[model samples]
Target chain A: MISLDIDKPRAGARVVVAMSGGVDSAVTAALVAEAGYDAVGVTLQLYDDGAASARKGACCAGQDIYDARRVADALGIPHYVLDYRTRFRESVMEPFAEAYVAGETPIPCVACNRTVKFRDLLGLARDLGADALATGHYVRRLPGPDGPELHRAVDADRDQSYFLFATSRDQLDYLRFPLGGMTKDAVRREAERRALPVAAKPDSQDICFVPNGGYARAVERLRPGAAEPGDIVDLDGRRLGGHDGTIAFTVGQRRGLKVGGTGEPLYVIRTEPEARRVVVGPRAALARSEIALGGLNWLAGAEPPCRPTPVQARIRSARPPAPATLHASADGTATVALDTPEHGVAPGQACVLYDGERVLGGGWIRRAVRP
Target chain B: MSARVYLDYNASAPVWPEAADAVDEAMRAGANASSIHAPGRAARARIEDARESVARLVGADPAGIVFTGGGTEANNQAIRCSGAERVLVSAIEHESVLSADEKAEILPVDPEGVVDPEALDRALAGDARSALVAVMLANNETGVIQPVARVAEIARRRGARVHCDAVQAAGKIPVDAASLGADSYALSAHKIGGPQGVGALVLRDPDAAGRLIHGGGQERGRRAGTENVAGVVGFGRAAGIVGERLEEFARLSALRDAMEAELHAVDPEAWTVGDRAPRLPNTSMTVMPGCESAAQVIAMDLDGIAVSAGSACSSGRIRLPYVLEAMGVDEAAAMCALRVSLGWWTTPDEIDRFVASWADLRRRTARRVA
Candidate 1:
């Protein structure tokens, strides 16, 4: 039986806390320091922007590092700024742009957490001789029969397990999520209790790379000639109108269609980048009963059941995980059949599966099929 | 390591032997310069002698120089003293200047970071009655020297005082306070082989009253508290050495030229900031397309070379150089710029090592991207 001690841990257990200059991470670092861990805060310098650096609310770049350093100084811990621009661009931004150009709605936060935060940052922590790598991600880890099992946060509203399903078991071993048990409000309260500088700092909503909420613009910047003008076609293959680029539209999107329909709202069912066309249809056509996933990574020791294994799958981060049956293939692919058809299941999105609260790993949705 | 090639001179250079010796001598004296006794008088003489040396190096009257903790403090003191209700500063000014006032208007620069004199004149001519103009003599990022004299003349005609943060320019160039004709000038000792914590702010008028630190009567009642005697002595010694070796050290300009040419050869689109403008001979700010400055700095460090992205004071903070932004370079390209500044200790072998390291880094970066 595991001992549960509510008291704060003793001080001076060397740990490296990844402080992203956000309220969550700032509070995490402060709590770790208060708990008697020799917490050394590190902020990844991911990009350069002179004007943006001087401006408020720009983190993960120059000014953010300064803010992190300031917080570290206030907390009386050693702070370091690591330059992870190349790694972040390759592992997060580049892939995000490429996926969009390939007619998919890519979620960059998953890639960032997987590659840059987990892999590269963990390697740095090891080099620094840190015992553990801590972040402010709201996910819990509990000792299970096999090893440490990843669990959903107690605060269901802010649980980030969906974005972190790709984290390997080995990576999880060295990781610590300090804000797992607390609600967002509690975290904010703790931040205020510690008198942390970013106590009421607003949460970052848009993609970090696409700072201006223009993911399409970021794609166009990366691949200048890739997003050519395309056609907005109906499900019957009739070109209804023209679109500047098929890359701008995502699966199940309803905005910017500019296609006049018979009063009923038309939604995007598909985006064909190769043909530069967006296929629009009725909202009912957006529902998908089954989704094929590729590049599957199962957090469990073995592959999920070759036959249907009952689980809960969430196609996107915001959506709740719906009851589904996951069928694993021999070649590391999986098919997830939802009990109730879900809407707007897009390719290139992560299909994270959960068994109760335990994250069972996930994969990118390759294709969504209607019943 | 092969002598640890020190390309981070802009961060802080090694204390010149003379400066170190002076510091040691002052430390040995063990007397407070403020005391009225004989020992105090002796210490006071040493402090004054050092002050004279520092003043001479920057072509300012000794009485006009007020020693401070360092460049940052000096910049803050000088900029905050401009006594203007509204401050007009070049976008490329150091963080000290940039953060002095949130409401300060930032004057734009061209692609080469040359501040348009007409733009300054127009800004000063506006409704800002108590506006103070602040522009650095040389940008810490690109080493791109601004047309301070032109800007100063414009500010003077408009009855505005000009403050130049000459920390990067003092030792690297022939800095004459009288020539620039700015109301106040800021310089850091460490940027010129002096002690890390000692710097001086020179006011064109000795009686210009603006005090950031208010306490005891020191620095001619302009600044407060006791002086850092050892550090001030080191600054004096370094300043004297810099003044004597000005012409000889200017030869580092050739090394900078060679490095710029080699970098451009490797990537034709790779740009050197202020290439056409007059700049510090030892500074090179190069932008390689698709290469991040922070990554290149890391790669250089792995190769046993120490370089900086822009100003070491603001190195880890990822931001485009304000100078570049004012020049209208897009944010993406600006983010990829790396600044390599040479110093008195730099040798040809080190420059060659840098070239080879950069070439290897380019190949590795390309491979990784592919």
Candidate 2:
């Protein structure tokens, strides 16, 4: 096993592992214990399964809590299950629904990482006298010339740096990612070698609060009457059909248009939530050459670059990074100029700036400009 | 195993050595009390002896003691056994009694968490239907002792039966069922340093207290299933010792008072719950402005001090305790509530360490908020 670089002596360094009852986190906890560090497992009960319907493929439920406790017992470590329902509901779930209501497709996981996991749970770890907080995130935190730096994982396909772009520099210093340098297969093998009970547990998919991928249902509950009927119109301003809710459609979406026979394929260009209208057009309309960003969070020392800097930007979690020039305005707003026109640049999705493999900064997309 | 000091006795007290020995002895005997053999007779004898000891602690007759699985079961049995069409329970009663009847009337309490006697009289007069009144002798969270005799008098005039949940008050205070005028009183073993999983419902009239678990004629057909001999032995031993240690346990109030005084000295805004009423000497619920209970608990636990929040959700996140909320504490102060309950084994050094740690936390929280 590769040795951990925690600050204190291995025998007494208290390490708190954010266990999610998954194989990855369980293995991370076992690795911490095996490295001769005192490992304390903590799992956040982020939502009430009764309040929000339990999704089959989602995690962090009652069963997951039980599984985490069993693993903690097997490892002979102290474990605590903290109730984070109110925090999660306010910070992640509520904002997610409101974002949809505002006609923006928000990434709840990014918001969760920014607020619940890093901010709240990190504070809890500090309160518990833990030297460092470790998670199963497949992202690397390596020591740089100045301090710790966030980078893409060795398993490039499973890299989660996009969702973690908003992690502040101070938090990065106290965070550890044990699965950062290993492949999923190797992690599974390590879980098997360590005899973890959740070794055979399936990977969680789907938004946890949205049961069975019922995003619209959750949104309706959060913002009552959010799914009001709207007009599905084309770029020419002719109504092709009547639809239900602007939140049901996102930019560049197809398949559920319900507008029959337009002679050519039409994609959602944008959703106007105020007017309660969804505008569809040819796929070319979805391409954007520039995007304005807001709520900028920079992972830099002292100050962020005020001048335009050339970097690669990822507009979506699954999309590859695109070459872009980030122009930082004095008033805290930023504009990204894509070297080549990128497609489906939507508002509310993160524009994460990358310098090769290192995450420089990120901001929420405010507007996509078609030039 | 470490040098951690446990101050959350209201949650569960540490098991005493004598109780452990009794449990071990009974477990070794391994006899069913229902059987007619010599071993079964020995088990029966132990169970009856435990019953007598438990009764003696609460000033009830041995024949009136009916053992149940736990305190919750005892309370449940008493509440359900009262064959009344309606139930009137104190708003501050434990969940076991509060949830016993779906439509149970809630009697309001004052700022000190004491049930108002006039409200019971008024409520009883308003409702001509036969009702069962349930009120806890002492609250688990704030340790405020309630007036059972007054409630009993009001209920007696109105032809209602009264059930007093003495789970928290039995060993900590002078609990005599005859003086309290409670038709039924509940007792738990674990709260007084016995093993868990054993408690008794002491009744004034056994016939009126209907059987909750009916199978074999155990506890004179009040509660059934073969007796938990080991658990009963531990409960009896713990109960017998608890009465003798009342004077000893009374000294915990000094430690509790010192801690509270130190807390107020650190943060003048720090407030104590149920300070105006008669309360159990060991418990103190202190609220510090702007410092959340969950964070305080974690910080104290890190410092090798064990305590609990006044009100916690199922996920263990601290919420405003309903008792405090009912007493009209604001959301901000309620969220900041911390409960520290001392017990027989809590030491002065431990109390000092806890107070220092708490003062440190208050300073840190004050700094962070600033």
Candidate 3:
């Protein structure tokens, strides 16, 4: 029986599965339908697939939509594709461009999951009279003493808990993640077992809207002339070299600096967008012991402004969570004191707080504190 | 669990049982229309019979009727093969017409969703000699009827060719190509309870233009490719059935009005777009205040009803509500509106069910947000 921690039994309970034209979501839908639930598959058209693929002529349905429709037909479940272009451009794409211009390393996927996917799509699922909204994300929701708790996936390497730290408690209560307990390989096998069409499909990589992996090009197109000419400077403000623009660089980056012959291997310290300057230094100058965060979402159900508490802090999705002390404030902000110095922490990244595999909650990085 | 009530007739209506039987019989008796054998001659006769029926539906010369793949191809052929240097279409035309030529000029509309006649006149004053003016008889989103006769008069008086896309209004209303004074017009079959993948374009001079497809001598050299004998037969049968019962649309309009009134009674803030304008009898664009149209559509579908939104196509792609936006409706309000189109198969019980379920949804979502 696939109760899914939902209030109702598996039979006749409606579940809306967010299908992304991928294998993981396909398996998720397969599992729900096999358990005798009325599963409805919903795919969001986040961008103009026609423009992205440059397909010409009278065709409106894209290949991704076609694939999703095929999977739905194979699974014998009803499917829908909702247009979210305007919503996505407003909530995710615009913020991504502005954050890049402000010299921050923005995580667009996180913004997508937090706003359009979780907040808006969840509302649609509820309106559709669905008992719950399920996704293929590798995160778990277990019944805790207080209520449902957001925890890490069973497969640590494929865990996506970092990107979903901004989910509110109310949203989580109506959500289900079926792939959290399985590894990627096991997911592929399960998909094959269920005879899913996308079982052999490769995983999607990089940013979805950014074509050809061209970040600077995408930013320049979004905000014309965003990559203005600027000067490269050392920590002491000594001019090193002239560059095309700061949009092409991020904190802790070593490539494309053009100042390769500096004594030790040079790393980007930070970008001053207002000054049109790129600051570079040795690797040691990039170390930060404290980080400030804003727009906090706390799932621990505890009020803020509490005393500094010990927890694991993850600054980037690529890095593992590290030992740290969390000092939360009442005004949707928090500061994390790392027990050991970490390198290359950038603004606009998330500092997710975790307590041994359980996600307490997290916020966006505002600035790195110098120790 | 219950019988599904399909209200998305504008997308594609349920095929009539007679048309289905015609198609099934045609498939059993297989022969190419182009062949010279007795079976082939029988197939050719069937196609000619279909052509006459399609021609009568639009009051066109039977010889001027040209069959194509579907409404989209008919539209592309009208605008692109009309031998006009400049193409101008209304802002509310279907995607097929609007995207036919990248440089085609777009004419605007008023808040009532009608094309501005004065604006059309001013636009064609200088280049009407080389222009092809295209407008839809009715909008697919709001079902607002355009002043096609007036537009055709302006375009023809100024020496410009006129084209009309009657895809949405053909079977629902009385449509005669000559009455509207259009040089050419295109319409679909499935919209009138016919088979998909088939449509016809009524041309003023069929022999003067035929460049859309060019491999075969079928369709009187106006279009190319072997004839879909079964599809054409089904279309002819459906057209005959739709033509005899155009009077029933008045009753559908009454049902639609009653449902809208009941819906407004439940939620006073809801909007009925283009209600004050001359519109199709069975089409309604209902806007639920503070609710997303996608959500409303999904909710209704779960309750065994089918509706739509301009923002989401039948194929499930998310599109901008450009039709409503062209009428000065804000994007926020436009996204909150859904399209409900009734057809020949709609029942009074279905309308009652829709009203009841829609009211239940309003009650469910009426809570205030923080």
Best of the candidates, DockQ: 3
Residue pair clashes in candidate 2: none
Evaluated at residue B33, the lDDT of candidate 2 is: 96
**Each model's TM-score, in the order given?**
0.63, 0.95, 0.94
What lDDT does candidate 3 reach at residue B258?
89
- Measured by TM-score, the strongest candidate is 2
- Over A12-72, each residue of candidate 2 has an lDDT whose tens digit, in order, gives 7888899988888998998888888888898988887762345432323477887887888
Candidate 1 lDDT over residue span A1-371, tens digit each = 11122234445355788998888999888888877776778788665556655767343445566677778988998676776777788898888889999999999998999899998877656544457889999999777777777889999989999989889989887888888878999989988887888877788777876777887888888889877998988999999999999888998899999999558899999998989999999999999999999988888765666777999999998899999999999787989999999998999999999998999989999998879
Report lDDT (Cα) of residue A77, candidate 1: 82
**lDDT tens string, model 3, A187-264?**
999988877888889988778889777888989989999999989999999999988989899999999999755778
Docking class of 2: acceptable
State each model's CA lDDT, in order.
0.84, 0.87, 0.88
In Å, residue B254's CA in model 3 sits off its true spot by 1.3
What is candidate 2's lDDT per residue for B1-370, written digit by digit as tens?
3599999999889998999999999999998998899999999999989999999999998888999998889999988877888899998888788777778989999988899999988888867788889989999999998989989988998999999999998888888898889899888999999999999999987666787898998888899999999999999999999899898888888888888998999899999998889889999999988877877887787677889996344445455477888787887888788999999998989888898898988877676567
How well is each residue in B237-298 modelled by candidate 3, as lDDT tens digits? 98888888889975799989988998899889898999999999999998888787877888
